[model samples]
Target: MKHLLLGAAALAVTASMALAGGHSVVRMGTEGAYEPWNFINDAGEIDGFERELGDELCKRAELTCEWVKNDWDSIIPNLVSGNYDTIIAGMSITAERDEVIDFTQPYTPPDPSAYVALDAGLDVEGAVIAAQATTIQAGFIAEKGWTLIEFATPEETVAAVRNGEADAVLADKSFLDTVAGTDGLVMLDRMEAIGGGVGMGLRESDAELRAKFDAAITSMKEDGTLNALIAKWEVASQF
Candidate 1:
């Protein structure tokens, strides 16, 4: 009886550990510069759509999440090198990216890209349109006659346009609408709608975690939590 009791206690401990360790504390990556998606405020803290979404998703998944700011160009490589367990920097789901990292089902669907000008009457046609490298917008810009000023992240692109260093910028419609009220900026025109949507990135081995996140996203969408967030952020027009 004593031996049997000891064996049962050992098995219980092992089972507890397995259950406790099943979920990982995922490190989520973001660009500290993309506004309405993820960006650093004047207070030097990260705030915006993606950050809020990450918080909500973490709550729904019942997992601990850490946010890490990284350059857009390095976001993927960092994921590949195990620097982050996931990325939530308004990253679009694309076949090219799937070749390396796994992605959750897209949470935010893509909207039309738009151009904005800081100065009135700029008369910009061959303006320098900014987009992050390796994005669908980059491919679209490559085919256009306008000068393309590629940036390491969307934050830099917005900054360039605000500083008058670039005539205009091409970005998601939500971002454009968010910046419209800022001094010295006006929307130019909405471009073709890009159909791809944003998703969280995970390592191929972290399929279980990805499944949890996808389920959480689906629930959020179904319960109107995601739409509430978009409304709270004042980005509903992009939908």
Candidate 2:
């Protein structure tokens, strides 16, 4: 009888430890400048679709989450170096990127891509354009007679255009909406349909973590929570 009781206690302890390990705090990284997806506000607070979605996923997964801001160019490297566990920025899951980091099932659908002008009379047609390096935007720019000015983040590219350092910037349609009516920028032209769907990035070894995130995202989509959050961020119309 004593042996039986001892074995039961051991099982309970092991189960408790497993549960504790499963709920470990997850470190999530974002650009904190991709508005409607993730961005830091003027008051230095992080807000947007990805931020809210991260919070919701943490709640559903029963895990604690910490949000970190980093340059978009370094986000993948940081994750690979263990600086962050997951990426919640407006990162697209592309075949090229898959060679480095794993991605959760995409939560957002691909939105239209556009080029925006910084000043009036600045004909973007056949002018140099800026976009975040290694993105689909760069490929699109390569097709045009436009020289590519690669920035570390979308916000930086937009800043360059706003400051007249670049003639135009290429980014998602929702980003154009967010930047419109500010910095005297206006949409120049819409380009070939580009995929800008957002996903969570994880290390290749962290398959379990990726699974949890993917499951949570699927649930959110099925129940309309994802759509609601998109609407709250004022980006649903852009999709």
Best by TM-score: 2
> What digit string (tens of lDDT, one per residue) describes model 1 on residues 105-205?
87766656777787555555667777666566666777766688877666677788888778887777777777775867888755657647778877776
Candidate 2 lDDT for residue 204? 75
Model 2 Cα RMSD, 1 decimal: 11.8
Top model number, lDDT: 2
What are the Cα lDDT values of the candidates?
0.70, 0.72
lDDT of 2: 0.72
Name every residue pair that clashes in candidate 2: none
Candidate 2 local Cα displacement, residue 10, angstroms = 42
Give all TM-scores, in the order shown.
0.80, 0.82
